[model samples]
Target: MNPVSVTDYRQLAKKRLPHFLFEYIDGGSYAETTLGRNMADLERVALRQRVLTDVSSLDLSVELFGQSLSMPVALAPIGLAGMNARRGEVQAARAAAVAGVPFCLSTVSACSLDEVARSTAKPFWFQLYMIRDRAFMRDLLGSARRLGCSALVLTADMPVPGSRYRDYRSGLAGAPGLRGNLRRVAQSVCRPGWAWDVGINGRPHQLGNVAPILGNNSGMDDFFAWMRDNFDPGVTWKDIDFVRGEWGGPLIVKGILDPEDARSAVAEGVDGIVVSNHGGRQLDGVLSSVKALPPIVDAVGDKATVLVDGGVRSGLDVVRMLALGAQGVLLGRAWAYALGARGEAGVTHMLKIIAAEIAVAMALTGCRNIEAIDRDILAELGQDINSRL
Candidate 1:
C-alpha cells in the first residue's frame, strides 16, 4: 500500500508490526465503548458546506503556549513509542519539528528525553506520569527543565493502569514467565520485518526514561513492573503544585473529561487541559473527548488552553475538534501507526496527509484561518448529531 491516509498507514502497521506491538497501540480498555464512541462521534460530526466564499488565501497556523504550530495538531505522548520503529520517538520529534508542530515524549518512551533532545534541537514537550517516587519525579522534571523542553504535560488520569484485555491476550501484559516470552518471540518471528527493524537492531530495548533505575532489569517485564509499582493512584489536584514548584514552563494537564475537573485544573493554574479519556484507553465507559468537549469548553474555554485527543484519525477530524472548540488536537495512535509502518518518512507523509485534509476541510467550510473555526462551521448544531454514523 502507498499509505495515502492515516487509516491506510494503520493497515500497513498491522501488517508490518508484531501482533503484540500492533495490539499495544490499537487496543483500548475492557469493552472499549468509549474508544468506539470517540471515532464514531467525530465521523458523524457534519461540516457545514459553504459556497462562493473567499477561502483562496487560507492559513492553518495557530499559536499555543507561545509556540507556533503549522496546524492545531501535536504528536501525543505514547508509551513504548520507540519500539514501533528504531528510536521512534526521536523520529516522530524530528518529523514534528519539520512540520512545525509539537511532539510530546512519554516518560516510558523507548528513547529518553535526553536522546530526543540530542537528536533534534527543536524543543519538544515531555509528559509525566505521577510516580510514587517523588524524588525520581523531580529528577525527570529537572531533566526536562535542563533540556529546555518547551512544555511539561502532566497526565492526570491513569493513576491506576486500565485493564486492557488486548494487551493480555497479545502477551504484552499479564502473561508472564517463560511462556509469555515464548509467545512474544513467536509473534515477533511471524513479523520478520519488525523482528529485524526493532527486535534485533533496536538494541538496549530499555524503556529510556526509567532505564537508570531499571538497572539490570531493563526489559519489557521491568517496564510493566515499574509502572505497576510506581504509578500513584492517590494523586489529587493539589499535588500538581509540587510539579509546578519544580519546573518553570507551560504545564498542561492531560486526560480531563469532566468540566468539574477542567474547572479544577483551571483553579490549579495549568497552562492547558487536554480534554481526553486517555484516547479511551484508561476509562472505557466515559464520554468521548468530543462528546465531553463542548461542556468543558463552556466551562473553561476562556480560562485555560483547551486541547483534545481521542479518535482524531484525519485532518477533517482535526477541523471537527477545532470546531468543537479545541485550540489543538493530539495525534496518538495515528502517528504511532505511521511510525510503525514507515519510520520517519512515514511520519512525515502522515503529517502531510493531515495538513492537506485540514486545508481542504477549512476551504470547504469557508474557514480561511484558525480563528474562523467555531460552532458555526458545523453542518447542523442541534439536529441530534450524536448517533453513530
Candidate 2:
C-alpha cells in the first residue's frame, strides 16, 4: 500500500506485528467506550470553510514550553511503545528530532533515557509516574537533568492500572506462566518477519529504565507484576513537590479530563495540562479528550499550556483539536503504528501526511497561521466552545 494516512500505517503495523503486540497497542480498557468516543467526537466537530481567502502564506510553527515547534504536536508517552519495533523508542526519538518536535519517552520505555538522549541532538521530554520507589524516582530525575531533558511530563493517571480484557485474551497479560509465553511464541511463529526483526535481533529486551530492579526479568508477566507492586495509588497533588525537588523544567500533567482537576493542577503549578483518558486505556466511559477540553481551557485560562491527546489520527484532527481551544495536540497510537509498520521512515512519512493535511485545512479555513485557529473555524462559532464538558 502507498500508506498516505495513519490508517494505512496501522494496517501495515497490524500485518507485520505479532497478535499480542498489536493488540497491546490497539486495545483499550474494558468495553473501550471512551476509546471509540475520542475519535468519534473529533469527527463530530465540523470545520467552517472559507474560500477565496488570502492564505498564500502559511506558517505551522508554534512556541511551546519555550521551545519553537515546527508544529504544535508532540508524541505522547506510551508504555511498551518501543516493543512495536527494534529499538523503537530510539528510532521514534530520532524521527521527532529531525521533524522539530518533542518526543516524550515513557518511564517504562525499552531504550533507556541516556541512550535516547545521546542519540538525538535535540533534547526529548521524559514522562514519569509516581511509583512507590521515591529514591529510584529521584535518581532517575537526576539522570534526566544530567542528560539535559527539555521537559518533564508527569502522567497523573494510572494510579491503579485499568482492566484491559484484550491483554488477557492475547496473552499480553493475565495469562501467566508457561501457557502465556507459549501462546505468544506460537503467535510470533506465525509472523516470522517480526520474529526475526524484533524477537531474534531486537537487543536489550527488558524495560531499560527499570531494568536494574527487574534484574533477570524481561517477560511481559514480569513487567505486569512490577507494576502491580510498584505503582503508587496514594499519590496526591503534594507529590509534585517531591518531583520538583529533583529537577526543574516545564512540568506537564497528563490524563486530565475535568475542569476541576485542571484548576487543581494549575494551583499546584503545572506548566501544562494534557486533557486525556490515557488514550482510553485507563478509563472506559469517560468523555473524549475533545469533549473534555473546552471546560478545562476555560478553567485554566492562561495559567498553563493545555494540550489534548487521544484519537488524534490525522492533520484534520489536529486542526479540529486546535479549533476547539487546545494549545497543541499529542499523538499516541498514530506514531506507534507508523513505527511498527516501517520503522523511522514510516514515522517520518506519517508526520508528513499530517503536516500536509494541516496546511490544506488551514488554507480552506481562511487561516494562514496556527494562532488564527479558534472556535471561529468551527461551524458552531457562537456556541462558546460547547462548555458542557
Once superposed on the true structure, which residue ranges of model 1 sit more than 4 Å away at CA?
Answer: 383-389
lDDT of 1 by residue, 338-368 (tens): 9999999999999999999999999999999
- RMSD in order of candidates: 1.4, 1.2
Model 2: per-residue lDDT, tens digit, 1-389? Answer: 98999999999999999999999999999999999999988888899999988999999999999999999999888888787888899999999998898999999999999888888899999999889999999999999999998999999888999999999989899889999999999999999987888888987788989998999988889999999899999999999899988888889999999899999999998899999999999979999989988888989999999999999999999999999889999999999999999999988888889899999999999999999999888886555666422
Which pairs, if any, clash in model 1?
none
Number of clashes recorded per candidate: 0, 0
- Please list the C-alpha lDDT of all candidates, in the order they appear: 0.92, 0.91
Clash count, predicted structure 1: 0
